[model samples]
Target: MFLTRAPFRALSRQFQQSVRCLCDKKDKDVKTTVWPPENKEKRLEDWKVIDSTELKPPPAENPITRTHRILKDDILRLKKYIPGLDGRTTRQNATMWKHTLFGEGEGFPEEEFFPSHCDIVIIGGGAIGSSIAYYLKERAREGLRVVVLEQDKTYEKASTTLSVGGLRQQFSLEENILMSLYASDFLRNIKHYLGDHVNVNFVPHGYLFLATEEGAEQLTQNSTLQNRLGAKNILLTPKKLKDRFPWLNVNDIALGCFGLEKEGWFDPWSLLMGFKHKAQSLGAEYIDGEAVNFEFEQNEHIQIQGVPSGEYNSTNNLIVKLNTGEVKRITFATCIVAAGAWSGHLAKLLKIGSGPGILSVPLPVEPRKRYVYTIKSQGQNQPLFNSPLTIDPKSTTYFRCDGLGGNFLCGRSPSLEDEPSTENLDVDYSYFDEMIWPHLAHRVPAFENAKVCSAWSGYYEFNTFDENGIVGLHPYYHNIYFATGFSGHGIQQSPAVGRAISEMILHGEFTTLDLSRLGFDRLMVAEPMLEQNIV
Candidate 1:
């Protein structure tokens, strides 16, 4: 049979056309179903007949053609539309998109390095880092200049690239919900700010969290908190859930909260690129360099050497040096660390806001590894174009339909103890089959029949202490600040947190939404705002 890869609407339209043609032919031997010939003709008659040959398999396809034809054409047309980067042929651009789906290609020519500078420096070019860069540039147009330091120009290894890309307002904390709301709004208008050149194919299908008896009480409480914030997602009783999702098996579920709106997954890398492109266009510079250490000067009014603080440093003169065999020096007036997992180490070195700047900075922000497995299942054989994301609280196994028939990407968190080495990102298969599969089978019996086809691993910057985000200025240092330890929800909250961080860096305070709840002071006070929605 033909593999169900084509767009549903398009294929449906084609089938309808053929059916109408066949029905119109002047033949009289007609066989029909429950409805009579007249009823069938009056109904959606065009769908009554389908070509027998269409049921057969499609001819063998090539590994390197067809679908790429349109992609290549678009790349060629959009090249001159974007500036800054040297002219790249369509073939080169095609390879880039291919690398996005598969492995990276041969390295490109290392261009002659240009010595550039900025007033404020941010380390990292992924979601958190790029957001800080963009917001600062937008807010501090007159006096603030920003530079984003990225170790990998493509950000292939960043958690932003490997995220499940889910967004929700079902968080237990008010600030967390508000921050995500800000991001949702920004994402809705992303094309406007980033440009029509960028398009994030965001599907607003909601998420359903099935609460188990073990966690039902806390989850229901969380739902109450979420609902109080005007998020209409209600906690469904087993009966109510059955009424809404009759197709689902809710025998094992206790209380379930379904985010019927304002939640879903999207292409993570696209969102990152959108921000980066706009930031670059607005004069923010993104350079390649991992921040191994920081240079800070201690005094009544402290100043970090490489970073510039418009208040203390010369205007338009920003630079930082990369730690290489040859000392590469770059100086910036101010510095913001958005280096995800590495933020902990960077903060330790600067002695700025360690453990929230005073009482104690016991941030349980540790790097943990997890695996993502995409599998083919006999259960969901049809193209899952409209399935909602289902989270089983009992098993902690999340399931969603694959765009392609008979397949979906699924995985689970590894306990902190058994996780991969913070530095080794290598993928392990046994972890999935042994740890994830048993739990998955318990929640969704349908998944019991699934088999893993492909898998990958990435890092989660776990906020171990309270599993909450840490935002705002570094307590000890003046110009140095941070927005890290978001745990896994970084991408969803990056938009608002980024704007908040940028506003703080430029104007010395929060202008829009108040972010006092996520400040670094939590560590010192020994009071952390914990959220219960962590997966």
Candidate 2:
């Protein structure tokens, strides 16, 4: 079978060409000579013709019109859930609902209409109050009606807006530490909870606490506890302190505790607005008004062991005075007092201190005016951009870089005997010159040339009793709860406090953080959950 190479190759090529020619002839015959040859033209035309109708694009839809259509459809779908809704009023109600959710045109009121009754009434529409509203509505959605009453919508004197917006986990108490930890996490993932458009502008700068020999032991203890509870901080000696912060005067400093992470400052106003907008979007109502008084009724059926059978006053209605000089009463199933500095006053309206037994103890939360001064230092070897929100524990003076422009914010809490008047939010510039400047100059010699560019004052919801937040239900009133008395930490702890309040209301217990020790029950027992690291 082995033929010569050239002859074999020539023969194989001839055979392959003959097979390919036969296959091509068979395919041509099958393609041209189908069973129904008469309809060949129709079959060929069908293959060639494309349906232009199917290829045509759909008409463009206006975004506004599409939004209206979607809203209308949603209204119709939700109409069934509303009992006693008739066909005649469906369109009108739907239009109102659309305007309420989306936007208001002329003749449509921008203010939230007063409701006669709601599930919960929150007194004070600051960051803490708004947060409670947000968390409640977020959990219950339309199933819950939450109303927040604020005296000032502008928030000119609001403690939340006026705060320096510092967030740190350096604390002596476990509750405060845990709350701050959650706050850092909440602010970090704020977009997931509040919306993608919301930003808190969190600046991740650590807080440096400088302690004298007298306070060195306490500082070390606090640092140890803070680190044990997932907080990252380091204790540095005098030499290390000077090395880390060369501009700092550590000649008298015995120890220094510096936070490594989850400690910083943010825009308090932004956070407050974020809570407010999200809460409103989730069906919480914010009314521009002041909580003037409470209407209480004695319930004979309900009895408490400490109170007489018929003397138990149950608070279910709140009288609010609107910004327009109109007063209205709102009945609520449960009420929360988060009035910040004014919480103590609101508690008085409920006869908290005037009443008998457990109500004798007031909220102990009052307004303590604190001043913040912004200074600019152009001296040589001034604190750099990396400088933290530094604190001198002995002097109770603290300062932090305001921006990259060599501006710094400095303040000090007044001595107990030298507390200033809180009649107005007036900043006393003399305070900085007499009380704060000397300490600042000593801490950083370069601060001697710093000039006060501006200054402002804010009221701390100072808890006179323990200087801690008064949370949970009041012993006298079963339906009343408190999320106030945070002193100066309310802005940072608003998220955790709101969630804790919501958990208490919705689940009848704290499901996440056990803040029982911070409850009003502690006030009755006269045990204060005091935190040593207070600025």
Candidate 3:
């Protein structure tokens, strides 16, 4: 019921009252750290006890509203005060909180016309692009200019919006683990970076990766790597896992690596917006359009557009063609292709990286489809599922409770085939019945008869070459850079990648973390930095 289309405005209003009451209390000795309870005589102080009839209006009982009311009452009872607050201040806070949940009801105004020239232009306006923009603004010298080109301003098909929003340091590669650690730290102190006006509701409950006998060795190895890279993860035996989470069926599990802290899910779209808004505040411009073609200046069969100190060359300039039939030629000092799933096509348009032919050295990123499902069990058991986000390595199936007790959200690994187009957002019903449900039911027993509520699909900027992120400048094109090929782990790693790219642009190398391990040169040298934990 919590995830349904039903509006939570009433609950939101009541919660606002509770927050105001907490803030307005004048008692210095009052304990504000705890949430107060309501209806103590009926033992409804926790607010978890509710029947179906309580959710309807009039007789529509507004269960969430009741929950908040009881919570406020408990707080007042604890403080030995009346349960009320200043009405005006309460209304103001309520309005602000409501704005945070549902936006201010404003539309994204179109960028009327394309710019003739700019210092730097970034393709794509998703999380990565926004992060780059924010970081560049934060690091650039005065008079620095930046523009972002986004085909879809609504972000309906953006991978960041479609992501499951999972953040973890259970990666096999050290760089990957480090990036996640950076992300966790950034997320924990997000208010300091993005301002107090924004919050992504990051819940660091943790992640549990289960491995059967066949994959135990690799899982163990990954756990060791993660721990060596300063991650707080521990390898759990079947007995330990069962002792911790009795809801999970660990009968066939050989090993499980559980993150003790600094890992979990959050609202990715909010984070993206925070980046975009902050970047805009710093004078970075975002335009709604698509990049179609690129024109390069050459002399004596030598590509000179991106080369800074080449001998056989001319003045470096490029004409970028947009889908709106307008082409602008400018000598940009640097350009970054931060496009996610469509990075390959953008690279093909430039044809500057390494491969067989000029066209062969594309970014190697493709659009791969992944599905997510939401379901709820009919069982009336109290807190039917209480565990970390669990993953089945053998089946590549992972799931977690969706904050509504019996309701759960689940997904599996990427499909074997690549999607023909990046625009496809349709979910396949058969995949659940045939693939995900069986594995989930087997692992949790309680999910055997779960009712499938809804499903959706999104594209991953899958890397055909190494499946790891590419985070540095191009090998051949000196000034051209890339921050793509994250396969499926871009949202959590965006902050680190953005900071690395910004450092590269400013100082010609990464200063904070050496992300050179994910450089384009690796692909050229036939040495891929293979990562074991992809899910």
Point to the candidate with the largest lDDT: 2
What would the per-residue lDDT of candidate 3 be over residues 344-451, giving only the tens digit for each residue?
767766654533332245578877878899988765331244467888877779898777556788988745662333345768877888888899888888788877
Q: Rate the local accuracy (lDDT) of all candidates.
A: 0.64, 0.80, 0.71
- Tens digit of per-residue lDDT, candidate 2, span 388-438: 899987788999999888899999888899799887777899999999999
Where is model 3 more than 4 Å wrong at Cα? 1-113, 299-331, 353-360, 379-386, 414-423
Cα-lDDT of candidate 2: 0.80
Weakest 10 consecutive residues of candidate 2 by summed lDDT? 25-34
Error of 2 at 211 (Å): 1.2
Question: How badly does each model clash, as a count of residue pairs?
Answer: 20, 0, 6
State the lDDT of candidate 1 residue by residue for 385-456, as single tens digits.
476677767556776765656677777766666666655677888887888888766655667787888877
Q: If both were scored by TM-score, which would come out higher, candidate 2 or candidate 3?
A: 2
RMSD of each: 22.5, 26.3, 19.6
> TM-scores for all candidates?
0.73, 0.81, 0.75
Q: What order do you get sorting by lDDT, best first?
A: 2, 3, 1
